[model samples]
Target: MIEIMRTMVSYLGSDHKHTALSGGDHLTCEREQGAKRHVQCSNTPGGRIEQLEPCIDGWHCVMNFMILIWQKLHKDSQEDYGTLSSLFARIGCSKAKKPKNDMHTCQAAFLKVFKGHIVTAGCKEFDIEGHKEVNQSLLSSVAQTVVKEFTVIPEALLGESVIDSGDKVHGYARVLCHFASLVLLFVDAWKEGDGERVIRLWKILMLHFHAEKKTKYALEALRLQFQLATLQPYLSHQLTWGRFINTHGGLGRNIPCDLHNEHINKLYKNIISNMGANFTKTASTWAARSVSSLHRISMAFDSPWPLTSRLTSTVKQQLTARGQMRRTSRQL
Candidate 1:
């Protein structure tokens, strides 16, 4: 999985080409900081890779990379930055200035923060900014805000009257239904996927997403809406999906969850913020911090990405299911 992910990253960055960087008579360390030494980097990709190994290893910056794509496509008339823009808040995809205590916050401003700052620092549209502009401190601030406000309102800006309510509701339902469909697709890829429980969860999400899409809604005719509401735990965690509560429902399958990786990234960024120092000078400190922040377990690098961390919160319902099973057996 990691290798596949790496391949995608390389492809996205156009780093797949292995070209000779430079042939030098000697290698020399330019500066010494603590036990780490900095070497002069040549203009070639190989030279840059060697120079950047300290910052890049063990950490994934795919989201930021995707933002680069989004920014380019957003400005260009040819691409579908429209759909991506719709995924974010205020059409700017930047963080909301106020606390998202209400309905209007989608919290999708992570890329916005960097894009805004980098642009402020002279990164023009479709122009790649220098690595120097990738400010750790700025990123750390934006990371926390994005996590805090990161949201997706499945239903937003629906019609006012009940006559047109179902249109928006059903539309939002379709959006969520499509997501469930994708999950089912990957579940097939994984093989031996537990379809029944997942199907139930999806139906529940679909129903809620539809209902939420309306200015006001009620299910007078449809069957099992009340039951599904009772069974569903999140009750729109996307609206309330802070770093604390977002991972609740996404861990059903045996495979690794995307939210698992995302939260780990958020945690890493939070630690970066709390450290309260520029990592530019102290980037060599990343490895030890990786042991503490990225892994966040005694097993550390031994365990896979999410198998351990997700088990605790995600499987509580399984225990509930088991207890219900025992009670059913006694009743029988």
Candidate 2:
């Protein structure tokens, strides 16, 4: 794996082909210092290993590795648990397939890859047919390594003080919600067009996302939500009736406030209700940014803002009218 990663970096690292005319007849090789800096190190299961040994573009390498890992994991999953009750029997629950709490499969895979032991709680003996002992052991070892490298740090969660606990919980809820939204989007994209590759990407992305959330993965989940929103309509339509999306991006006319405005409004309500008076401006701003980004992306797919000024005027007028009605009612 190290050799493979190094070879990839060698091919991607240099800008030797780039040349600039320094004089009338002389062509001097020019290098892109920024690109060189951008890919200085690679993030791997082993952590940041070596920086001087040909800088491995961390983002690119990780992305590529994620693609590879997802492919391998997906293929392994299909082979192991693609059947109906087969998966439930192995993982002990149907919900294990959920991208957020894939503890079962993750545990299994971690064990398989690193520990070399598959711990089965209980299942019909028939379900274990053709299970080679050797393969199971190998997979368990790999799984152990993965679990150690990526599992969340419980200490961090426990360290939050009572006064600021809401922030931590809100952050968690936001991440899970955003993750569900993105997974749904990927599913929707696959349902729409050209989603096979996207679906395959979920495994690695989920792993990395979860790993980051453990200690230092702030806002990655939110950022991913933005990226996914712009790419495909995960939260495009109401997942159910009476659902609404939120207005996102900038305040502009002609942006129909996103088809999913109802959902966003619902989310806002839930967030408010849950957090109550404790909701901070930071949380509000985070939610607002979500709405704004969605609106901006939604608008891009439709008409340019021609009615923004008109809409703003109407909203202000309505609010003013409502205020007057309340004042009159109070006086009465």
Candidate 3:
């Protein structure tokens, strides 16, 4: 998803074309400004602005949601700042500091609070003996973990609607929670390869998304919805062939290509970084080849038969534990 968005951004350059009015002093100023700014403008009866809207991927979708959550929390804090501060303090998020415009801080802070909530609720609801902790290693997908955990947030923690509307009842936080839960349900259906359920959930989610247009993050929400809509056909295609191609005699699950690509990119960058800051392309290529050859030699020496089995078993264990955690979370 990140790769796709980057490609689109590269394709569409920084300055987009726009139309402006003509036959006036404003037209002269517009032309002058266009020439000065190195932007193209045309005279047309009706003005058109070429706006580029990038598709929001899962990572960005969650990040934007976190931003909205943070904004709403702070807005509500104006009424009872101490209450909000204390609530987050319980999760080790001291000092309700305003996050920067980047939204990374917002995501990290909210994720910490959400993870804490999930751990506390899970321990109590599952009646686990001893001091058990959630296996953080199992949560490889931040978006999935966030949406899944959000479904079970205690109602007491979701404060009342700070927006004083005579017609509306539910607050933005509650609505957003429902939306995230719907997304998680949709993902679950997709994982199960239930096409009908996936379609149904998609429709329901679209309806809810349209209803959320009145919220503060309406444009961001719309972008997320558009991204989901655009990916539906691609997701359907994956669902169709995923099981057959990904499994060996119906043994394994389909790995997400986006995550796989991200992992590979990270590995490549790590390798490049290890070779110092100023390595040529040819040198980097040789370095990668050398590493590959060394890995193959090591595998040959260490017996290749156990390697595959070991990886498969490790993956299976992790998947099993993750599934158990999800089931427990749903039950909670």
lDDT of 1: 0.32
Q: Estimate TM-scores for all models.
A: 0.22, 0.18, 0.36
Off by over 4 Å in 1: 1-179, 187-260, 277-280, 283-332
TM-score of candidate 1 versus the correct structure, residues matched by position: 0.22
Question: Candidate 3: lDDT of 50?
Answer: 25
Task: Put down candidate 3 lDDT per residue, 1-332, tens digits, no spaces.
Answer: 22323333445555544211111122232343344333224352111222222221232233334444455455434233223344344334444455435444444444443333455444544466334665676445544444344343444554542333342212333343453455455445534545455445434544444464534234433433454456456543433333121322343343333333344455567668877757897877676556645555665798846655335433322223334334323322
Model 3, position 222, has a per-residue lDDT of: 49
Which scores better on lDDT, 1 or 2? 2
Off by over 4 Å in 2: 1-3, 10-182, 190-215, 219-332
Per-residue error for 32 in candidate 1, Å, reads: 29
Query: Judged by TM-score, which candidate is best?
Result: 3
Extract clashing residue pairs from model 3.
none
